[model samples]
Target: MSATLNPNIFRAYDIRGVAERDLTTESVVPIANSFAAMLVDAGSRDVALGRDVRASSPRIAEVFRQALSSAGLQVYDLGIVSTPMLYYGVSRFQRGGGVMITASHNPSPDNGLKLLINDVAISGDRIQEIYQGAQAGRKIVADGGAVHTTDILDTYVTELTEQACIGPRALKIAVDGGNGMSGPSITRLLDRLGIEHIDLYCDPDGDFPNHHPDPTQIDTLVDLQRTVLEHGCDLGLAFDGDGDRIGVVDEEGRVIHGDRLVIIYAREILKEVPGARIVGEVKCSDTLFSMIEKWGGDPIMSRVGHSFIKATLRENGALLAGEMSGHMFFKHRYYGFDDAVYAAMRLLEIASNVPEDAPFSTLLADVPDTVTTPEIRVDCPDISKFGVVDSVVSHFRALRPVEDIDGARIRFENGWGLVRASNTQPVLVLRFEATTDAELNAYQSEIMEVVTAAISACDDSV
Candidate 1:
């Protein structure tokens, strides 16, 4: 937080900004130092650090490592790794916490840091403390801490391979890593597991030559879908830049929604761990929650955001958790963290064991079909987004029953609508789902009217 640093880079979840404009070595030094100071203040010494495959990531990460070491914190450097690997390193190394230098699903030329403390994501006030401390030029007077280089690539691949419980069907799959951090690790894991697969953009090219490393986008997954069909692969999988969230396509080249993917996992998990807790974000489809209940598993809906989702998962001992944004976490037989690579492997395991007559999509055929919209983001300033959502909440709550857990999810007789503020960007996230197209349109239209009025009021007041 030097005088030139942009404080806006510190967001509700992680630290992020344009690489060229805001995140320079000068800015990274102070930010890293301040974060290390937090660790020192917490009586912690060892901190693991990793970076994605972005062009600017390595440079910023190097400076960050130097600053952390200079700030008297033991830095365990896991160079060029996915975000999940950084999380795993913290637990694998038994460190106080860790940091991942990534922009996640953002476009190239943007980068930032995701921090952890005590193996938990640091957000909200905890993130603010680091920014404030940096802005104030807080310092911890102590000798420089040690920096150690450790490679967990082989170990990570081996662990994932062993945990993969796929049957011996030798199913073919098409995988699109989108030239992000997932290539090497995923290829190695699949090879070891003896899964026949076709790889697309499976090299770590920061340029992202084929497509943006965002699986959630329709344009980005186009190649994955085509390749799956052309190659006669049973399914296709896509990963984001940092390799934590996932996107999937069935044999028919149809993109499976995130909520449906959760149902697939919950069905398998509930059979073993009956009455287990299953968590989903408020934006998730109601069908997902209902299916969980039908399977005898308790469903808990929480606010969206990885940090909040993980915290809720841990608190409830949930066997599985997911978001509409494609993040899936498993506490069933593995660590309770979101890893797209692992989720894909697990999906493959499930797909391979099914009978020849039943395909992967067939497993979810019983889910009540509903018309649902993908998350629609409305442009609203960061300063005013929350206020707009609050206004919407108030306007809708008096007229109908609403669940205000994270946002206002207004439940109608036949459908529901959600209005929430996006944590990372200046936008208001909205979604609508209903059993019928007419109901869906009515719900969407009514909610959008309220949202427009609320935003107008919020802007005038602000």
Candidate 2:
């Protein structure tokens, strides 16, 4: 029963890797056993568990349940639910902890676990500890912890509807679930809110037959844009594989970036709660931070990742926090966890109040324009990405002022360039923003030179 676990799968945010290679049923049992032991050691008697519709999910969930029960921890299995719902269930039921069997936008061939301890998303050193325990072949053998099957979809939909503010505008929306986990929850929530919507790829198919579930990639949103335009809908919304992140399109079939979405959401929320603190990831546009301040609310920059941002939100008592990758967390009227379906509903509520003559783009007309790069993901070996980041950080620190908040964000006079290791993928994430095209190019060139040099040095050393 002692399978060698891949330490790389124990990522900064969650556990993820190729299902066939890193997440075999045998390997998953040890992980689950370690998780259950962690909960039991912390005095948690019960756990709320859920999974996505991936092919490996059922087997993984069953093995996990067995492990939990074996560790003397009751398991409330919410079969085939989204990541957000898993978080909601744990927080709602006041359970000791929860585990979501999902990879959240990773490809169909991949699967992973999103862990929660005491209602907080677990990450960093805690995740490392789990890996260490599993490697040590640690097992907690106990007796008499029962497993119960439960459905929280209806309850989740009802709760979100109660807290949502649906505008009186009878708007038409087109939603593409990308054969991920968003369809059922979003459709139900929209139905309860009395809004008209068209569903595309709403059925949860683990194969992801229509397209990859990651809407942040422009190509993935093509079908959604076509659907919105063809249906003449007022908006189009797309969700990742686990429904925790969202990608949106305006009425004119234009994909809206996360920073722009923040502007719209913050404008509405600030009107109601003036001076409320709002947070955006370090990768977000500078305009977003400045605009939040202009709107009379404090803007706090945070490290990317839902777990990190959620912790920051609570620490600052911020009502809202978002990332450029589409993870939007709202604490205004809902839980602090990132929930895309709820965010889409909130977007609709905001759009309904806009004048008929204006478009969603108009809502952000006042924001200053700047040249920025779409998240540039440079592929690196999982073993080397972190080293690459560290090397780059060291190289840049001697040249310009660098902010190592999450990564090295080298600030220049006109703009800033970021180089960081992606927590979820084996890639070095890079982004740059500048006041003009020339300044943007200069900043990008300077950072690219350092990154290339560091990567080469890393490879040479290896």
Candidate 3:
């Protein structure tokens, strides 16, 4: 067998940890071998291997390629591409699997692998299976296992631009790539579409020295916001580490969150595909679902996570889906995967219709203003986090009607709140929304009270 596998590294949707500590060359080898076996089981010997621009990524990717090759799989090396590009590379084949090496939004020292099997996102049991197989150290050699280095960036750009259905006018915008994987691809997209943009940290750097490559955290968008105001641009777009999540700033330098982004996309999409279903996670603003329904589209409320929302989209055949964490997925004339670069273009596509004289914030003028809290992450042990969530569910379920698809989404008379265990971390994520500050505070107080009690109880009892 291989070195004792770190169970913590095998997360829900990915394998993530501090690279040198948890994912040594010895560890990655068996993991890659296991993933190769997974591809083989899926009736495909071809595996797409891609990596981010992190300093440690190349070494990890090389280890993976070697292990995969040794395991008798044809490895398609799509070098130094974003996570979405890696997904796209795998999607090129009928039955394909791939691994993207990047700890999305995590710090520089952290690294991870997001896996897809037969182009379907792997999660839950599948990830655990990989971990189990890795422990087993299954390695089989077959003929014709080799590495095929490929270049699909131009083709990806060509296809994305070919499907362009934007307004006539082009506008100057600011783009903050966060020195991650979004630089080259977004620049190429902006160039092809004739969109003027001011670049902010558009070069890929593993250290992410400027700011953390997480667009969801408002702290990370300071540079992007400043750039937009200084440039007198119509808007700003920010991308996360692996270029799958997007953050936007309006002409007035207001941060437009993912929920607002979804509404904007939904409004435009409804014009073309009326009554198309859209999915958004519970952490999203209630306005997202209400507006989608009001705009003649079916809105499906999903649990918070990429894999869960993707499964919801497939189940409902939704044309679009989004998360509060800045992941926008569109099957409307494009692949249904979270791609910040594609979503940025789509945002521009919608904004292009707006008059040059008007500010971009006007697009959301109809979206009823509401008070919403950013995600509040409460520290809870992995063992007790879900239990605490369940206690919260029970407490709320006894008090009022609640939805617990992934957590307790309690809809109070004046507001709504969510309490759920994070899929990838040992924390209970909470968010609240209301029409007024008082209502928002009341909702938060009520939820936090129950959450605190439940967590205390979990700690003492179990």
Candidate 4:
């Protein structure tokens, strides 16, 4: 039977869609079969699979597993594990590839698949090939494929605890999983690491009864910040829906953004692997690049997306890479998958080694302060967002000097502004960084004006 895929659902980086409308069983089964066929063609007979805490994930994963088994592939079901765990399983088992059923920071109503080939992320143009193969009914089915179930929770915890460099510091920590897939695994790992802490919303609930699973949004971390302050914990950590990304709060209950977290991680990583290459997305603060260089490491900027970051890291042999959205990849001690649980352990290890008075907040103290706007996204049609960015880029290039990295970054004497199309959402993303708040506001206003003008131009053309 041929699989039907909505062309709209085949995105640039991964497969994601609302479960009810875009990812029905009919659409998923054949895709899974085709994926298994792809693996067979690549000489891979065994594949690992995992899912998140969303209600639809279990059903969807089952259908996919059936397809894989029917196609003559061995399926290792690491049930209800994080995306990172799936990656680790694939790398550890030396299997063909892995699939993670998750919408990753999306709402509970959404579900999707993140595919890996030989432990490397499959994205960009490769996603198109997979969709095309599935639609053409070109899947292979053999007689030797089998399905097996195994729980890797204990192994995962042991790996994280062993990798962490924690010391004798009896620090109190607060962890908020937002009722996502990270709860059980993170709690287990923390306990094994001998860390004292409070766990909030650590129950696996698809309903997300506490708040949305996305920790990048300030509102989502409000409860976590409060919990840390109330408990007088040394710090706080929060994970997204699939537990692949992390957001942090300091001992003083101050929220730390991903760029700052990267700085902290980079500093610690440098101690172990000096002069290593580190990569950051275009959205990261300029200070990060400077600091990495000052620490005798090379800093490379890449497009925003975990796939892009991972591919770039592999190509450049980078030790670490991160984005402003809390996706961090580490290659020093483990495979370079973005794992928030592992990241939290690394942070704790670094904190344990620091002076008694030195805190996580101190990592950012030496960098010059810059006023910047939090990533502001404007809702627009998916088709319109990219065109709007192109139009804005053209206009900015004509009117002033701009850096066309991942987007149009207009440079001024005291500040810089950027406007880009979000790869993961139907929105236009805007950010500004400046020497002063007033300069930052001016740059933001100017960029807004340009973006507004570009939208008008597109509207007129339409």
Candidate 1, residue 112: how far the Cα is off, in Å? 0.6
lDDT of 3 by residue, 85-186 (tens): 988887756437888999989999999999988777899899999998888877666777799998889988888898776787679999999999988999
Q: Return the TM-score for each candidate structure.
A: 0.98, 0.97, 0.98, 0.96
Residue 196 in model 1: lDDT: 87
Q: Rate residue 37 of model 2 by lDDT.
A: 86
Which residues of candidate 3, in runs, are more than 4 Å off? none
Colliding pairs, model 4: 72-145, 73-145
Top of the candidates by lDDT = 2
**Residue 179 lDDT, candidate 3, scale 0-100:** 94
- Candidate 2: tens digits of C-alpha lDDT, residues 1-462: 557788878988899999988999889878888888889888999999999999999989998889998998889999999999998999888989999998888889999999988789899999998888787777798888989999999999998888877665678889999899988999998889888898899999999999999989999998889988898888899999999989999888898899889889999999999999999998988889889999999999999988899999999999999999899999998888999998998898888877776766677677788899888889887778788888888888998898899889888997899998888777899999999999999989988988888888888888
Query: At residue 92, what lDDT does model 1 achieve?
Result: 65
TM-score of structure candidate 3: 0.98
Per-residue CA lDDT of model 4 for 306-374, tens digit only, reads 998998999999999998999999898989989998888888887776677676577578877778889
Q: Which residue segments of model 4 deviate by more than 4 Å?
A: 1-4, 398-401
Rank the models by TM-score, top first. Answer: 3, 1, 2, 4
Instruction: Look at candidate 1 and tell me the lDDT of residue 309.
Output: 95
For model 2, the superposed segments whose C-alpha errors exceed 4 Å read none
Looking at model 4, residue 147 earns an lDDT score of 79
Candidate 2, pairs of clashing residues:
none
